[model samples]
Target chain A: MPQIAQLAQTYASQIFWLLIFFGAVYFIVGRGMVPKVLATVEARENQIAADLAAAEAARAAADADEAAWRARENANRAAAQAIIAKAKAEAAAAREARLAAAQAKIDARLAEAEAAIAAARDSALAEIEDVAVEAAQDIVRRLAGAKVTKTAARAAVKEALAHV
Target chain B: MHQFTIEPVVPFQFAGYDLSFTNSAAWMLVTAVVLTIFVAGGLRRELVPGRWQMAVETFTGFIDNMLEANIGKEGRKYVPYVFSLFMFILLANLLGLLPLGVVGIHPFTFTSHFTVTGVLAAISFGIVLVVGFWKHGFHFFSLFVPHGTPAVMVPLIFLIELFSFMIRPFSLALRLFVAMMAGHVLLKVLSGFVINGANAGLGIGALVGLPSFALMIAISALEILVAGIQAYVFALLTSLYINDAEHLH
Candidate 1:
């Protein structure tokens, strides 16, 4: 019984100290820790926003540079194609002019062959007419028996007609 | 040589000053461990709570409902402190019934001691003092001086009121410790009768023993009731203190 009475005195004191510990924690929470945590969170969020904006600006600049490079590349390609076309046209014109010159030389050779053939026909016809007339006059004189000595017989006939 | 019968080991003391890690402290630590395990187990956050979770929920909800009914909207904010305070007292009281030889000086047992209970009272008083001042500021001082009193009676009223106010923690501590201590002593006294009768003779011993045992059982039951009642009184007073602080009354 005495033991029980004594025990009561002991336990009551322990409860007193626990409350002081809790009170201290409550004060620290209100005064400092909560505000610092909130400030850190706000600062982190703002930093992320700024980084994102800077990244977007850099991307836009890169896109514009790429577009300008592409336009110059396209112009270079078109100029190269035009130069090729012009070189091809010049080659075709040179081929045509060479062909025309070869054809004119061939036509000049054909005209020369025709002129030689016409001259040969005229010389042959004159030689054939002279042979035919000589033969005919020789046969006629052999049949008639009248000796006609060319200029001399003609001169004799003229003198006899004068005397008559 | 006579064989010695050594005294049993009490709670450890340092340089003749016992830290008084009494039965109440042991029980309080046990309650803390139990709460920790229970909370940790249910922390999985399942859609449907398990049996253990449900039990903890019942206790938390019971306190929640109490705060709601007693202090209304402003009461809910005080749930944590009230919860800790109630558990401490409840464990301390229930631990007395443990067969681990608490009534007989074992390492772990609920002891009816003013030191433990008084500490709890002082804590509550401290909280009341600090929170009241913080909430109500200098206006809280007005409670000591009642309104509409005659100038002649003011001095007398103020002294009485101050004494009564000072007694809040003292009375609260005394009330719980006294009831537990007295009840256990009564049980001890009743059990002694049966032992004394057996030494006299079998016939007288059996006659006295049976009834004495029955009386002991009854006292045991009453002790259990006292335990719960004292714990409730402690917790209720804590909440009332909180309420008084909140309202500046």
Candidate 2:
């Protein structure tokens, strides 16, 4: 093979160039560039982690705000309910007081009407007795041509009303 | 044979040694330039990388993972050398297989030459030896003696293990060189059949040329796979060897 035949002649050049080029590759690529790339990877990872942590903090804050808002809303609802119940109880008490005052006035007026009716009835009875006595005396006097006394007639009318 | 021949582009000699700039050397230069451009494009340092940056990271990450797996945390120190070695071989192998011959450019596979592969393997082996001696001193020799051996059999086992250990560089060189050279030779031989049969007659062309052409296509695909696999094997073995040196196991 030409490889073996030319080995003695070509080995030196090949080895020399190989070393020179391989050394260049080692220094330029391996030593210089690799570390930079790895650093970039690490930086990206840290940035992502930081972003995620920030998002988590924001979420927690939002949840806390919602919880506080919910508690305030519940307190306000309870306050409104208590105010409504108090207003309802006050209205009920006022209505009961007004009804009791009206009942008392109605009872007083009914008693006064009954007393006035009793006095009118008593005066009307006395007037009827006087009329009856005058009519009796006038008829007796016209028939016998004599006058009648009012006191005696009144006493006689009273005895007759008692008997009737 | 002509494909394998080395012709000097610029002849030079220094100190009684011929180190002429040859086609092989030119390709090595091309490999370096191409690799530089590839890595340079990825140095944008954007947090969100583009496709080019991603491609570069994929390769570096692959090597990093391999080293971490094989040599543990200490393997981090050898990243530059191992990364360069893997990328150089991988690019050189793939560049050789580029279908540029149609444009009258016959790309040389430098890895096909034993001298180039031998030197690469020597470097890896050298690192292993230096690290082993430096870290463990005389105790590095005990790597040859497996744990829990019979006292009488320890010497024999040690000799055998030493022989295998010494042959590592040679084996590494031979494996890459043979794999590259054999694939190219087979492709060339099959192409010869396709040309010869086509010249002979249409019937012979249909019979021999057609099948050879089909086979060349399949083998070309397989060669691409082999190119990647060989590069990976070289890097993996090197890392494993470094592991042994690091821990002396």
Query: Which one is best on lDDT?
Result: 2
Candidate 2 has which clashing residue pairs, if any?
A: none
User: Residues B70-187, candidate 1, lDDT per residue (tens digit)?
Assistant: 7778876666666656655666567656556545544232335566567768878988889888888888766777778899998888789878878999998888878877776677
What lDDT score goes with residue A6 in model 2?
Answer: 93
lDDT for B49 in candidate 2 is 90
lDDT, residue A162, model 1: 50
TM-score each candidate: 0.55, 0.83
Q: How many Å off is the CA of B168 in candidate 2?
A: 2.4
- Model 1 chain B weakest lDDT span, ten residues long: B1-10
Least lDDT summed over 10 consecutive residues: which range in candidate 2 chain B? B56-65
TM-score of candidate 2 against the unseen true structure: 0.83
- Top candidate when judged by DockQ against the true structure: 2
